[model samples]
Target: MSETTHTAATTRASGPGRLLVAVYALFAVAATGRSTVQILTRFEEAPLAYSLSALAAAVYIAATVALARSGHTSRRVALAACTFELVGVVAVGLFTLLVPEAFPDDTVWSLFGIGYGFVPLVLPVLGLLWLGRSHPRTPDAASSAPPSHRG
Candidate 1:
């Protein structure tokens, strides 16, 4: 890998990035467990909500894996996952609000993730910001050029 790509990958999973990855992992587990139980126990109670929870869990899992990896593809995947998550949360949040009767129970994104302390709503924003800030630095021509020698 080029230095720029390597640096981008390493920087993405270091320091605060580690914390972000950990949080994504936590959300993945939580959403997966919640959706599984809801689907198995009482899917009929709130099929849409339960299904949405499952979808959210899948997205979280993808984001966690992508963010934890080190590669250009992983970075793209992370970006897509985070963007999707943000859109999903906003759309679902609005749906639940505009049509309260549409969802018998709450999904992870209900009321902008009120159930999860708004983490779902805020996490993607953070992920996007981190990705933006951690972009690969292009090596300039001067930096790549060989040094001149004085006779």
Candidate 2:
């Protein structure tokens, strides 16, 4: 017959998890501020870029929220947000390369996130990697069964 037991252990705070949270937070702030500035300063000059900036802000906000939550639900949301961010960066970067005039002003993703020191380009990649690393262990693996004491 199989036996089951449970024990207590203190899991250390995840360094990558914390880093992920921080990066997401930074994006949240940057995207929000950039979008606000663009919308207020010259929205008509580049409506597509400005609108994309708003979308970028929303995605960053969602990513931050998801990373902070750190549960099944939040993980899913984070995955989605990261995927969208990657797609957005790649698509926008390519578009800007192929169609220069199409983008009269800069958005968060313009020129592969050049304005943000490429952090915007790299963040989602790191986010996805961290997400994979932080994936929840299975029940058997996560079990806290006490070590056997037989000598």
Candidate 3:
């Protein structure tokens, strides 16, 4: 890759990006676990609830993968996934609150992510903001200058 591209890629993978990736990984694990337990034990009781859990798991998995990959494409994918996650959390939260019967059994968003200390409620928003602030690297002015030719 060209130096420009390399710098861009490196900046995109900065400390905040790594931190977000870590959080995404945690969500992946939590969502996977929640869905697996719901599916194995009580799927028959509330297919919709369990299915939603599975969907949450899938979203988190996608976010984790996308964030961990470095490139323009991966950044776009990660942004979209995080946005969708935010929407899902809000919509599911409201639905759970307004129509308790809709969720015969609790899924992850049973009480606006009360079970998860609302990290599910807040993480995506933070992720989006972080993504927005991330800038690709550019050559520093000093580095861009040609070396002086002295005797």
Alpha-carbon local distance difference test for all models: 0.96, 0.79, 0.81
Better of 1 and 3 by lDDT: 1
lDDT of 2 at 72: 65
List per-candidate RMSD values in Å.
3.0, 6.4, 5.3
Clashing pairs in 2: none
If ranked by TM-score, best first, what sequence of candidates would result?
1, 3, 2
lDDT of 1 at 4: 83
- What digit string (tens of lDDT, one per residue) describes model 3 on residues 28-133? 8988998998899989999988998889889889888877776778778888888998888899999999998989987776677888899888888877777666
In the range 9-73, model 1's lDDT, one tens digit per residue, is 99999999999999999999999999999999999999999999999999999999999999989
Superposed Cα RMSD, model 2: 6.4
> Candidate 1 at residue 140, lDDT?
94
Of candidates 3 and 1, the better by TM-score: 1
- Which residue runs of candidate 2 sit more than 4 Å off their true CA positions? 1-13, 139-151
Q: How close is candidate 2 to the true structure, as a TM-score?
A: 0.81
Residue 91 lDDT in candidate 1? 99
Off by over 4 Å in 3: 1-5, 137-151
Q: What are the per-residue Cα lDDT tens digits for candidate 2 across 9-125?
A: 011115666767787788889889988998999998999999999999999999888777735667789889999999999899889889989999888898899988988789999
Candidate 1 whole-model C-alpha lDDT, 0 to 1? 0.96
